[model samples]
Target: MQVVGNALVALVAALHLYFLVLEMFLWTRPYGLKTFGNTAARARDSAVLAANQGLYNGFLAAGLVWGLAHPAPVFASQLKVFFLLCVIAAGLYGAATVSRKILLVQAAPAALALLVIWLG
Candidate 1:
């Protein structure tokens, strides 16, 4: 169970890392435009905002990785809880402000991992 929980946490971290790449490095490219449902012009216009968002996503990934790597179990658990909660909060906000897909794409995985971590 602990292993499963850790795997889920890692999965969420990886997702965030991917998001960082997409938003930061690819925002003005076809891949990012398609992902965000933006036209090239729109993507170019919002590139700065997307990069800022990507940085935040990177921070989330880093936090999750830090939590997983912590030597102290209690501290690691606390870190995971904190970062996961932040992910959930961001997801909810994004869903409300940007797109409903965010709820499924972002929040759901983190919520699942949090549940498994608590159960484990």
Candidate 2:
């Protein structure tokens, strides 16, 4: 069970890292624009904002990894919940304000992580 929890946490961390790249570096490129549905100019204009958001995601990833590594008091599970909540909130806001697919791609993984950690 512990191993399963840690594995899920690790996967979440990696996913967030990929998110960091996609948002911060690739937002204007084919991959990011295809995923985010934005023009090149618009993506470039939003680069700074995406970097900021990506930074937060990176912090969340780091927290998950740290929590898994140190396992003092089920910190991984707790942080996973917290991080997923943040993603869920962002996804909701994005869906309401920006895009719906964000909810599917971003929130879904968080939801999956939450489920795995809780159920496994």
Candidate 3:
């Protein structure tokens, strides 16, 4: 159960890293446009904003990674909970302001991982 929880946390971190890449490096590219459902002109115009969002995602990822690497078990769990909550909050906000899909795509996984962590 602990291993599963940890793996799920890692998966969430990886997802955030992918998001960082998409928003920071590819926001104006075809892949980013396709993923985001944005037109080329819109993507280009909003690239800076996307990059800023990506940086935040990267910070979340970094926090999760740090939690995973922490030496103290209790502190590690606390860190994980904190970061997961952050992800969930961001996801809910994005869903409300941007798209409903963000809730499922970003928040659901973190919620699952949080459940697992709590159970474990």
Candidate 4:
């Protein structure tokens, strides 16, 4: 169960990292435009904002990784909970403001990880 929970946490971290790449490096590219359903002009207009958003996603990923790598068990768990909650909050906000897909892709995984971690 612990292993499963940790793997889920890692998965969430990886997802955030992917988001960072998509938003920061590819927001104006064909792939990113397709991913976000943005026209080239719209993507170009919002590239700076997307890059900023991507930076925040990278921070989330970093926090999750730090939680996973922490030396102390109790502190590590605390870190994980904190970062997971942040992810959940961000996901919920994105779902409300941007797209419903965020609830499924971002919030659901973190919620599952949190449940497993709590159970473990």
The better candidate by lDDT, 2 or 4, is 4
What's model 1's lDDT at 105?
96
Quantify all predictions' global Cα lDDT against the true fold: 0.96, 0.78, 0.97, 0.96
Residue range 61-109, candidate 4, lDDT tens digits: 9999999999998999999999999999999999999899999999999
Error of 2 at 70 (Å): 1.7
User: Per-residue lDDT of 1-120 in model 3, one digit per residue for the tens?
Assistant: 989999999999999999999999999999999999999999989999999999999999999999999999999999999999999999999999999999999999999999999999
TM-score for each candidate, following the candidate numbering: 0.99, 0.78, 0.98, 0.98
Per-prediction tally of clashes: 0, 0, 0, 0
Candidate 1 lDDT, tens digit per residue, 11-50? 9999999999999999989888888889999998999999
> In candidate 3, which residue ranges exceed 4 Å CA deviation?
none
Backbone clashes in candidate 2 total 0
Compared with the true structure, model 4 gives a TM-score of: 0.98
lDDT per residue for candidate 2 within 1-120, as digits (tens), equals 767766766776897898899888888889999987899899999999999988888987887777676656666567767776776777788788877787886677667777777887
Candidate 1 segments whose C-alpha is farther than 4 A from its true place = none
